[model samples]
Target: MTNSISLLAEEQVPESYGWLAGGIGAVIVIALLVFWVASLISIIRSGYSVGVKILLAMAAFAYPFLGPLIWFLFARHKEHKTRMDR
Candidate 1:
């Protein structure tokens, strides 16, 4: 009974889905790389001082996904507000 159940479980899972999962994962990684690169470029081009630029770049490099997300959600808006006041 145990052998038959194990065989049935293995048969039920399709092997073809491996490629689909790999493709999806590759797309996600590429998107993250693009986003990270864009964030780095934005930081470099902003009006921030040299020290601030270094710190922001470091944060982005260290945290990868979370760092850019924080910058976009919080720091970017703050920078925009400061610019508007100027």
Candidate 2:
């Protein structure tokens, strides 16, 4: 019984800590949303077709840095070279 009580106490977050945690969470969420919107805009402006733009935007929003890196390497950069070569 004492162990269970201690566990419950440990699980209960202090109010101050809770507010701090909530603020931090809000910041993280806002940052991610900003990043997603920026990435989506970049994808849209890159002259890709609708399907590719949607795919890259989704990837950039969902997977963070890796998604943009892959898109840059495989799609954006490839198109740049093709245009330059032309």
The best candidate by lDDT is 1
Clash pairs detected, candidate 2 = none
Score every model by TM-score. 0.75, 0.57
lDDT of 1 by residue, 1-86 (tens): 99999687667756777567668989999999999998999888877778888999999999999989887777876665555334
Distance from true position, residue 70, model 1, in Å?
Answer: 0.7
Off by over 4 Å in 1: 1-13, 80-86
Model 2: per-residue lDDT, tens digit, 1-86? 99999677657977568777779989998986776666667788876567777888788877987787677567776656544322
**In model 2, which range of ten residues has the least summed lDDT?**
77-86
RMSD for all candidates, in order, please.
6.1, 5.4
Colliding residue pairs in candidate 1: none
Best by TM-score: 1
